[model samples]
Each structure stands twice: as C-alpha cells, then as structure tokens.
Target: MIQDYLRQQVESKDYQPVFYDLKNAQDLHTFEALLKSRPYIRINDEIYSQLRELMKIRNPTKRLTAAEYDEKVQAYLDGVEIEKFGVWVYYPWNNQVVHLVNEADFIELRTSRNQHKITAAEIAVLSKKKIGIVGLSVGQSIALTLVMERLCGELRLADFDRLELTNMNRIRCGVHNLQVPKVVIAAREIAELDPFIKVKIYEDGMTEANMDDFFTAGGVLDIFIEECDGVDIKILSRIKAKELKIPVVMEMNDRGMIDIERFDLEPERPLMHGLIPEVDIPTLRGLTDAEKLPIFSPMLALDNASARMKFSLGEIGKTITTWPQLASSVVLGGALVADTCRRIALDQFKNSGRYYVDFEQLIV
Candidate 1:
C-alpha cells in the first residue's frame, strides 16, 4: 500500500523551495508552529561564515587580528536583526530548513573569488541578464555552472524527459531521483546552490506552445541554448531565435565542438549557418530517429565529429543504443558554453561562428 501511494504521488510532489521571513511575526509564528510539528527538520545555519567572508570582501585594506576579526563578526551579528539578517528557506521534500544571508551578501560571499576577473561592475551587469537553456542532459552542467557563478539574474530551463538509469553515465544525480523530470532536478539544484538565481521550468520541454513565452515572458533572453534531441524542435528553435534576433549557442558534446549564431548581431544570418536545407516543421515531426538522422547529422556536425564518436553513431542500432557521451565531455561542454555565454553577455565576444576546444588536439 505504501509503495503504491509513493508511486502515484511522487511525480506530482512539489520541488520548489519556500522562503520564510522571520522578521514578520505571522511568518515567525508559522515557522515556529512548523518546528513544533516536525521536530526533526534538518537545520543548516551558515550565516556567520557568510558574514565573516563578507567582512573580508568589504574591508580588503584592513588587516585584522584573530581576536579583532571575531570581535567584528560578533559586532556585526549583534547590530543586525538576526531574524531579518537573511532568509529561512524550507525544502519540504527533505524536511530541511537552511539559513542564508540575504541575496546581496550571499552572492558577494559566494562569488568573492571571481573578483577582478569578473569585476564588481561585471557581476552587476550579469545580474540583469536572462539566459534560457532548452535541454538538461548536458545542459545540466551548463545550468549549474551558470548558477555557481551567478552568471544571469534569471535562468529559463526546458526539458520534458525524466531521469532514466541510462542517463547516470553522464547526467549527475542520485539514483533516488530516477523517473523525476530533468527540469525539476536542475531547478532543485539551482535553488539549493544559489536561491538568488531565478529558475523558470518548461516541464513540457520546448514546444511551439511555450517557445514565445520562454524567450520573452518575463523578459527577452540575452542568450538561448539549444541541446534537445528533436530535429523538428531544433529547427523550429533556430527559426524562432532568428526571428527574435536572439543569439543561439549549441555544443555538439563531441570533440569539443560549439556553434554560436549571432542573429542578434546579424539578423539576416542563415539558420544553422546555412548548413541544412529548409523544411517545414510539421513534415520534420513524426519521423523515426533513424529517418531524422539525415537532418540531425548536419545540425550535429557529425561529419567532423571525433572518430570514436562517429563509430559510436554508426553502432546506434547494433551495439550501442544511441550516441555515447562521457561525463568528462559533458562537463567540458558545460565549461565551454558557460564561458562563451559570459563573454557574450558582457560584450567581450562579438563574432558568431563555430569553434572547437578539442582536448585531443590541444593537450599534445
């Protein structure tokens, strides 16, 4: 009976975090009531360490003795209203409550190491930009890196697939999460890593229904990342991106190949750099994976793919189930996409074209 209940309700369970402001008496009372109701709620209070690091960043010119540092820490702690110092985030799924410094101090302390390299001004600039990623297999790495660095103020995610056992080879997540939607996993991870970043989920994945809103609902995206498996969706996305003049970034996830189309820079630029002939979206749909390979190969740039990757592609129907990917390659693609997006968001990289970061070629 218990197993049946869990199987029925797990998919509909809420994954989003809830924030409570202890500064409000009503909220405080509710939180206290929650504490009484669930006495075993895990507590994670790390605001003191955050305050300590925040002090160092704020006073780079001042050298402090151990005693003085502690004194300063205590003084700051005493001055602020402890309850209002940060937020109490409750993760209902795990029955855990985490205390974190507010967005400003939290972001500053978390990304202090990126200073000068990212500059305080650049961080502010990045905080105002919005980024959308349509696939979460390899895009999972890209999204995580983006949140870790606080790259964008808002991140829009779209993925309709669920976490399968086979995805364990590349996508990082616990086995317990098997059968959960990929977007939920990505969103939950983002909420835990940095609550400051706004993550919008397209649970149905990228479809014509939500494409417009995905790009422009809250605000137009500064960058659009495409990583889904559907050939029709890929073509449609580029067409929409071209129409909106939004730049598109895609990583082939093999031999470190990445493509950047600056439709925002050159609106008239051909879709997929004119690599594939135009086709109607309805005709592209309803085709088998084998039938889609002709159009898919060109978009994936399979002609120049690594030799092993090419062989793996050929064995899809015989030996392997599909294109084989490694954790290493997916992570590498994540770094590549994140860096390119950051530079583009900051106007550091302007030209649009395909580029390679092939480790095999660069290492030797």
Candidate 2:
C-alpha cells in the first residue's frame, strides 16, 4: 500500500527542464561575449531603419538622409566595447542577440516609457541610489521591476529559501528552477537584464549575525524593501533602518497593501508604525502557526484584507497549507513597491503611511 501511494504521487507530478545549464567554460565565454558586445549594425539597411525609428528621426522634420542616419548609428555603436570572445548567446530561448550593446544604451532603449514620464535628470539621480531587498519570493518581482525601470544602480538582496514546486504559482520561472536558491535566481535574472548594475546577495538570508551586513555590508542603502516572512528579521530590520535613517517600503501581497515607513524623516517611528510595538524578535522567533496568526493578522491589516485573503488566512495549516497568493497580486506588489521606492528616492514625496492597490475594490 505504501509503495502504491508513493508511485501515485510521483505519477501525479509534472517535471520538465526549463533553463539550460551553463556546463563548461565555452558556455561562460558565450554569456560573457553577449554581455560585452555592443549593439551594432547587423544588416546595414535594417539597422538604419531601426535607429531612425528608435531615435524618432524622420525626413523633413529633423531631416536626416539615410547616409546621415547610418553615420549616427555607427557613432552610437562605436561607443560599445568590443566583445573579447566574439562568442554569441545561442540557447533554446526564443530570441538571440548576436552583438550586445553598452548597458546604458540597452537600458535607455528598454526604459523609454519611464524616460518619457521622468526627466533625464531624475533618472540620473535614481541611477546613483542603492536599494536593499529582503525576501526574494515576492521581492523577486520588486527587484526585477526596479531593474527594468532603471531605478537604482546597486541592489542588495537577501533570501535563504530555495525555489520549490510550490513557489511556481507566483514566481516567474519554470519547473527546472526548483531547488535553486531564490537569491541565485534573482541575481541571474538581474545580471542578464543589465550587467552594469551591481547586485549583492546574502544567500544565507537575513539573520541576527548577517542582518547588519545586509544593511551596511557594501554601501548605505537609500531605500530598504522588507518582504521576508521571518518575524525576527522583519522587526530587527526596521530597528536598523531607523538607526541609519534609510527609507523602508513593504508590500503585503494580499489586498495589494503597501506600507511606507520613512525612518529617514521620522527616526523615532516605531516598527510597522507601532502595530506590534511591544513584540520583539525573541517573542516572534519560532512562533507556531496558531500563535503567529494573531500578530500576523494585525501586521497585514486583516481588518482591511480582502474577503478571499481573510478567508484563506483562517485556513492556514488546516485545509490550506499556507497563505495563498495570486500571480496578479504578486505582480501588482512589484509595481507598488517600485513606484513607492522611486518617489521616495527622488524626494518627490515624503509621506509615511499605509496605502492600498486593492484589486477587489478597484475591479468592482
């Protein structure tokens, strides 16, 4: 009976490889070449047209002939460093880039929408700021969104958890990624997106011993994102943030709630706005599910939580194994955190309070 049950469980599982492993030095060389190569003219006519479109240059308005456009394209390409290995990135992925461009040019092209909204000066300011993120499950979305928007030059990430089959519901990865450390996955994604930006990882996740290093290991953070479920780190991080005067942002990922604590402006502010002012790390650590629910409910603002989420919370460790999170909600959390961090870093707003992007209310 036991053997039959185990076989049934194994049969029910769906397993497939998603990402190609970098096995040898050749693979490394190809990846390096892809990172180093600059965007250059592959086919002259095609590249010329692309450059004209990208630059929004047209004849008769900011009139430039084909030759003139070609010259401009060449000038841009000249600035990119030549690939040392001359290797190309060829994987099972949908698209491939023969030549890579400078990080700045690539970012500029990718973040055109953001550029349109904010001034170049604002972007320059954002590029200089360093941001730290703890808990890569939902934090992964926030990190990627920040990178895509070019919000910061450096990112510090901490998460000791490994990716599991269960994490696939919200995390944007494939089955093959199971068992990979969350930090490694996030770092690889960021590096592939923009190699110029620096990423510091704490593979052990934030703890009493390493939490200090995560905050002040390399450079002081302009903004700190707290998303880990660890009750101890959650409280301890805020204490440190208050001491350093760094701004803090968090997303509940349930009911689309966002919490902003401007420790920078209000150094005396209690952790989580004093929601659990008396609860210390010792009391929080090693809490049972039943014991944790009381504190967790208030911290997440259960009174304001959606009906579905509130219902789900009640089922934890019962019918449900854990708190349920939707991909839509997780993705929304990323956008909320990114926008809040950007506004704070740019000094455009200094409000410290809780905000919501509740989908239930919004959709209705």
Candidate 3:
C-alpha cells in the first residue's frame, strides 16, 4: 500500500490555472475556500491599470486631466463590483490569485502596443491557430515567445526530461524548478504570463505511439517545432509530419542554421532535404544514443558549421559530455523559430529550404 501511494503521479490539473468568476456564487465559494486552504496573495491592482491603459487606446488623441483619467478608468469598472468585474485567476502551482480583465479587454490592453506591427486582424487570425513544440530546453524560449505574441490560441509541449543544473545555462527558470519536468516549468511560466493560452503537455515525450495523437488530438497543429536530441525521434517525426501534411521547423544552435520542411506544400519532398535516405523506423529506433550520433551529424550540415563548433563536436565524449549550447544561442534560435512560424502561419513566407542567420559572417 505504501509503495502504491508513493508511486502515484501528480495530477495534471495542478499544473494548470483555474479561473473564478466571482459573480457566480458557487465559484466565489470555491475561491474563498482555496484562499483558506492555501496561502495566497490577492493581486487586483493590474485590472485597474489595465483599465487605465485601455482608456488610452480608446482615446489616443485625448490629453485629459487626472480627474478625467481616474473617472474614465472607473467608468469601465462600474464602481467597485469586484464580484462582477474582470476575472479571478488561481494558479495552483504557486498559490497566487491574480485579477485580470475579461479576455477581450485584457488582450486589447496587453497587445495594444503590438497594434501596427501585428495588426488587430492578424492577432485575431493567429489566435485561432495551434502550435506544438517538442523538446523543452531550447524549445522553452521559442514557446514563450510564441505565447507572448499571442501567435497561437494553444500550444502543445512534449518533453520527457526534467530540469538539471546544466540546463540552467540555457533553459530560463529559477533553481526552484530543478528536477521538475521541463513541460511543467514551461506550463507554469505560460500560465503566469497568460492564463488564456491552452497548454497541453506530453510528459512522456514524443514517440511513434503518441505522435499521431499529439499532432491531431487537439486539432491538427498549424506548425510543429522539433528540437529534441534523439536522431530516431527526429526521423520519425518528419515522417509523421509529411504524412499529416504539417510543416516542420527547426534550428541548430551551431551555425544559426534554420531548417524548414514544407511538407504541407510539397508532400513528395525528401526528409532532411534529401540528405537523409529512406529510413526504417524500427531500425532507427533500435540504435542507442551513442550509435545515433553518426546519423545526427549529417543533419547538422557540418560543412557550414563554425570551426569552433567543429572542434567542440570533436571534444564530445573525450573532454566534454555532449554538444555545447549557450543561453544566447538558444534564445536566438527561439526568436528565429517564433518569427518564422508566425510568418508561415500568416502566409508571409513559402517554399522549403535551409537558411542561416549566422552572426559570425553578418556581424563583420
């Protein structure tokens, strides 16, 4: 009985944020109970601040008196009806309750600055799209950027690895998150950023068994981001993406090399831009991590890799554990991915090919 108790897994609900519309008597009761059960901080000032910014967006040409602005902000609140105003967000992971305006007003105020750049119409279209990112180390930054831009309504994250001290160099998170599953850390951070984004996690990582479901279970992903370390999974994922007509995007932290496979447009295109030959899933699956390194190097496009990166690769297993990655490179990769995915989803870029944003050559 003790062993069974110890083996029980944490419930998925704990990782997600719950909303409370205090106007509803039942939800209000639950909210009160939650506060009593766990130590929680109430944060409602942001809602009024949201109202203040929203007033500016609506009246961009006006320069009103302090009294006028305060009144304007109050006009939307309708005079202190906390129960009926905005929303009460309860995050179980951190036990913090945040007060936020309704979705429409919150988005308007939050993304107001993004106006001319993203356009209100584009934001609306992007909000309907869904993206899936596999692997959470570097994928963490990419996923966060996508959410920050409100580029997608939902994000599906998959990772079987947990945070470690070494990952701290690249993956952004507090040491408190050490040993926690990467998906959990990303989900909690996303929740804190925007409770509206629907995040689905595959703690078990991507595999042939769940690949189909991961791509389509919550509606076919508009874009799929692959950043895992396993060669077998990479091959398997592209095969599935091709079969499902989903475009796949990736970045190598080495030479700023970005790879895009427009399977949705060219169904017959070869995997890895014809660099990798036809592969047998079972055969690739049977290869161990050490054995898969030979196959993975080709995907790196070594001829373009920086000389230092080449030397670093040679150091693997001899002087170091594995390929080296820096926080800057990971963050840069994230930006490249988020921008590319957004453009593709918005129909701004087309065609399948390899591109590089290498700073070494461009900086000079």
Best by lDDT: 1
Against the correct fold, how does model 1 do in TM-score? 0.95
Candidate 2, residues 118-184, lDDT tens digits: the string is 7778888999999999999789999999998889999998998988988989998877567778887
TM-score, ranked from best to worst: 1, 3, 2
Clash number for each model: 0, 4, 0
lDDT of 1 at 188: 88
Which number leads on TM-score? Answer: 1
Per-model TM against the reference: 0.95, 0.79, 0.93
lDDT of each residue in 311-361, candidate 1, tens digit only: 887777787677888999899989999999999999999888889999999
The residue pairs in collision within model 1 are: none
Inter-residue clash pairs, candidate 3: none
In candidate 1, stretches whose alpha carbon ends up further than 4 angstroms from where it belongs are: 1-12, 74-78, 81-84
Which of 1 and 2 is the better model by TM-score?
1
lDDT of 2: 0.75
